[model samples]
Target: MPRKRTPDAHDRILDAAGGLFDRYGVHAVGMQQIIDDLGCGKQLLYREFASKDKLVVAYLERCTQDWDRTFARALAAAATPEEQLVEVVRAVQTMVPGTRGCSLRNTHAEFPDPEHPAHQVSLEHFKAVREQLRELARRTSAADPDRLGDRIMLIIDGVYASGATLGATGTAEEAVALARDVIRIETSLPVAESEIPADVR
Candidate 1:
């Protein structure tokens, strides 16, 4: 009879892989590293994940779920589109750390072939994120939807390229300030048409 596998093998492998990928990127990590970190035999790891590509897809999916929850919660905090936009920026503000870069962007740069299993999964995750930003742009009254959407995407790319080494947390804050300015410049505060309604005085 085959020996029973450790119950925590799945999570431990993912945790080890996530730390390695987030810190050094997926390509930099190897099966040896995973096996060493997991302290498990090769067969056990294979039984759980099958392949590195499949495991990578799982990790990216976890990131996506986490981000979606954050965005949804922030959006739910406000009643108006403009307010929701600010909250969205605030949501992004919380995502930065000192070492690891954005997981999705890192994967995109590391995976050379678009058809690579992990690469395809990352692409889908990216599309979903971009679509979310576009929807945020539509909700934000201060900037034109398409243009602001493009600019936000650009800023995000810049943030990833900046990396922790360049102090990207400051970049996130600066981006928020810039976004507020963009909104202010494009949108005027709603004003009464120089006369009060008789019913409201």
Candidate 2:
């Protein structure tokens, strides 16, 4: 009879696989590598995940959850829609350093076939993120909320791409400042009292 799988076996395997996938792109890593990293029997790993594709799907789903958390944190960190949009960029900027960029993005590139589950999941995530940003942008005073949302999304994409390629010192370092400027310009927001000349005040 096959040995019973532990309650945490699936999570254990997933966690190990996620770590490896994060370090190296999904395609570069393999089941054997995950088994070695997890120190679990091959049978056990297979029992938990039918195949590598399944494992990758699970990993990407977990990554989507992580993005949700990031979005939640950004919303909680700020009061206004403009601040929240900037906070989203700040959140991504905070996360991209010293890593292999966004996991969903890397995995998306690895699986180019649109029919592939990984690719589909990545596309869904991108759509969800875009909608969330648009929702926030609509709440702001921007003349064009959709445009503002797309602009912020571009900044986020740049942050991840630059951070992964050039590290923290590259264009990634300017992300927050650029986001602030974009928000200010898009919203046509008034200057802060501190920025106003004392004589004028």
Candidate 3:
């Protein structure tokens, strides 16, 4: 029987898998590719990951941690909820062009089984992002935060799609502009001042 790989070996495998998953996408890359990329044996890969699906889950989990920390930290520095929203949108500008893909979106794009742990995580992340945005929108505007959050999410989805398709055509700039417009519209909306939620920003 193949010896169990050490924790270091597992970490290395995950590191390699994440890079490959990000660069080549989850569906596009395979175990052999990971093995070759990691320069680790097949036994080592299996010992660490158990199966491809398991590794996929690990990859996504890692991404979630990375994103959670990044967004949380970004939101921390902003003085207001509205400022936080603009900064977050501006932050994503760095990801536009090139592959222009979202890690969670790329992972779940071809997923047929929503029951998969990776798929579930994707759904949860999506919901979390939407809620966060909704709260931010509510804090930034006078109207219903839920409605603006939904609209912002719709535009965010479009921005992701546009980023993937726009290549080097200044899509990042365009996404920022669109997001700013959403914020502006939100500020102009009429609602009781008391309706706006406290900043979780």
- Highest lDDT: give the candidate number: 2
Which tens-of-lDDT digit does each residue in 64-93 have in candidate 2?
898899899999999999999878888886
Count of clashes in candidate 3? 0
**In angstroms, what RMSD does candidate 2 have relative to the true structure?**
2.8
Each prediction's RMSD to truth: 6.4, 2.8, 6.9
- Model 3 scores worst on lDDT over the 10 consecutive residues at 91-100
Preferred candidate (TM-score higher): 1 or 2: 2
Ranking by lDDT: 2, 3, 1
Best by TM-score: 2
* Per-prediction backbone clash count: 0, 0, 0
Q: Name the TM-score of candidate 2.
A: 0.89
Poorly placed runs, candidate 2 (over 4 Å): 1-7, 169-173, 193-201
What lDDT is reached at residue 51 by model 2? 91
- Ten contiguous residues with the weakest lDDT in model 1: 187-196
Q: Which residue pairs does candidate 3 place in steric collision?
A: none
Give the per-residue Cα lDDT of candidate 3 at 182: 68
TM-score of each: 0.81, 0.89, 0.81
